[model samples]
Target: MRRPAFHTRLRAHASACGGSSLIEVMLAVALVAVSALGLIAAQVWTAREARAMSLRESATWIADSIAEATRTPSVGNAALNQWSAWASVLLPHGDASVGESGAVAAARVTWASVRDRPTAGDGIGPSAEPCGGVDAPAGSSCVALAFAQ
Candidate 1:
């Protein structure tokens, strides 16, 4: 028997390997799609965490400002009201308060997190109050600082 021609052998090999290329292409697409989805999820999570951190930083600043104002006897109710108004402008559903007990004074700033409204707390972390021992309001986060007079 005569062996097949080189061209014929090549044709047979190509036909046999054709389906594998299609399968390989499909698998490659699938892998790329899965990787893209994972990256998109990571981007979303990063954006959410960034927003949360920004809100936390704003709350801290407001709390610190209130604490500083409390140190001055000349800064009275008007100044406190202004700070509270500022907080409301800086954060969603924001509020600020100052409390004094004995020789210690505390400043607290609270705001509702847009992503945590339905859950009633910071959903990303352990379910704990942000304002030290005090429980923050439902759906809200807080920053509190205490100083001795």
Candidate 2:
């Protein structure tokens, strides 16, 4: 019997392999989609962290300002209130307070932070006071500075 021509054999092989290319393409597309989703999640997390950091930096600056004002005898409660007002304007539900414990004075800045989600068993929530024992609201973050009297 005469053997089939090369073109015929190639055609037979191509027909046999028909659906495999489609499957491979589908798998590749799925992989790319999953990777893209992961990248997008990372970007979102990064943006949230950047915003949280910016808020923390602002809190720190406010705390430092409080400390400076405390050191200066001329600076009064009005100045401190102004700083608190500034914090409120700059951060979400922000507040600042100055407290004295014995010889050490503390400046506490508190704000509601998007990143302050309550984790499991951490016991951190609205009532949890993390900033030098100051009463921070729910889902809030704080920055505290202690300076000598």
Candidate 3:
């Protein structure tokens, strides 16, 4: 049985490169799992920020709509109520308020969400809003307009 010189070299190389140990494989898997978990966390944060931005955009739209309607004689508390109802339906614990004094008007919308995955609404969550509810942090969006005298 005469094996080729190359066969002997191959056997020596295989012995030298005995693949990964159990600990090495475990460590590699742990690192991969950690990286995946970090990626997932970042995705979750992005989703939350996206949702908050959407709510802010919607609030701006609602404020603009209310301001436009404010010109009509029939627009007042009823319009605010309708918009409040609409906002409530659109966002969790959503509320809308409109205030007018003389020639100035202000519209604000507030909502709640667990943007930072806080165990509780500790008043220190990321971008905490003054209008949030009990279980989540609050966020507010507002706009003000003045009519010509």
Best by TM-score: 2
Q: Give per-residue CA lDDT, model 2, range 73-103, as digits (tens).
A: 6775877989999999998899999988998
Which candidate wins on lDDT?
2
Q: Candidate 3 residues 1-149, lDDT tens each? A: 89999999989987887775666999999999999999999998888789878877887777676667666767766787788898888876777766656666566666665444543356554554332222223333433333421
Per-model C-alpha RMSD = 4.0, 3.4, 4.9
Local distance difference test scores for all models: 0.82, 0.85, 0.66
Off by over 4 Å in 3: 18-31, 117-149
| lDDT (C-alpha) at residue 132 in model 3 | 21
Writing each residue's lDDT as its tens digit, candidate 1 over 28-144 gives: 999999999999999998999999899889988988888888787788467779889999999998998887788887888889876533462536555556574477866677888
> Which has the better lDDT: candidate 1, or candidate 2?
2
Stretches off by above 4 angstroms in model 1 are 1-6, 116-132
Shift of residue 144 alpha carbon in model 2, Å? 0.4
